[model samples]
Target: MPRFTDAFRVAEESGQTMAEYGVVLALVTLAVLAALTMLGANVSSALTGVANLLP
Candidate 1:
């Protein structure tokens, strides 16, 4: 009855929240990976330059 519907609603809300969190986490992970991929070569080259200069 009323109590059962309330319990169900709470569960549905919690599940929705979990889905939102998962989507956000996935987006953040993608952004970070893309940034690293784009910058990886540049960073490596810079480090090599620094190393060459040190010696």
Candidate 2:
């Protein structure tokens, strides 16, 4: 029936959309992790400097 075919099509499209969202989320997570790793040492030093100035 037409309704059955439509339901299948919708499910397939939904799956594709979910896959795309998952890929984007993975890429964004990787980017954030890379940024933190690259900045970790500088951020630590900056915090230490501020702490030293306080006490």
Candidate 3:
């Protein structure tokens, strides 16, 4: 029926949107982790430097 078809279309669109959001979230998470990994060494050095500066 027409109602059933409309429901199916809506569901399909929602599923696509969900998939897109999931991909974006995964990419963002990966980017954040990569940034942290890259920055961790610098951060550790900075902390060490700060500690050395202390008494």
- The best candidate in terms of TM-score: 2
C-alpha TM-score for every candidate: 0.61, 0.69, 0.59
lDDT of 3 by residue, 1-55 (tens): 4676666555357778899999999999999999999999999999999999999
Q: Each prediction's Cα lDDT score?
A: 0.89, 0.90, 0.90
List model 2 lDDT by residue over 1-55, tens digit each: 4676666555457778899999999999999999999999999999999999995
- Model 1, 1-55: lDDT tens digits are 4676666555447878899999999999999999999999999999999999995
- Candidate 3 structure lDDT: 0.90
Q: RMSD to the native, candidate 1?
A: 3.9
Model 2: runs farther than 4 Å from truth? 1-11
Rate residue 44 of model 2 by lDDT.
97
Model 1: residues >4 Å from true position, as ranges? 1-11, 51-55
Q: Model 1: which residue pairs collide?
A: none
Question: What's the residue-level lDDT of 37 in candidate 3?
Answer: 100
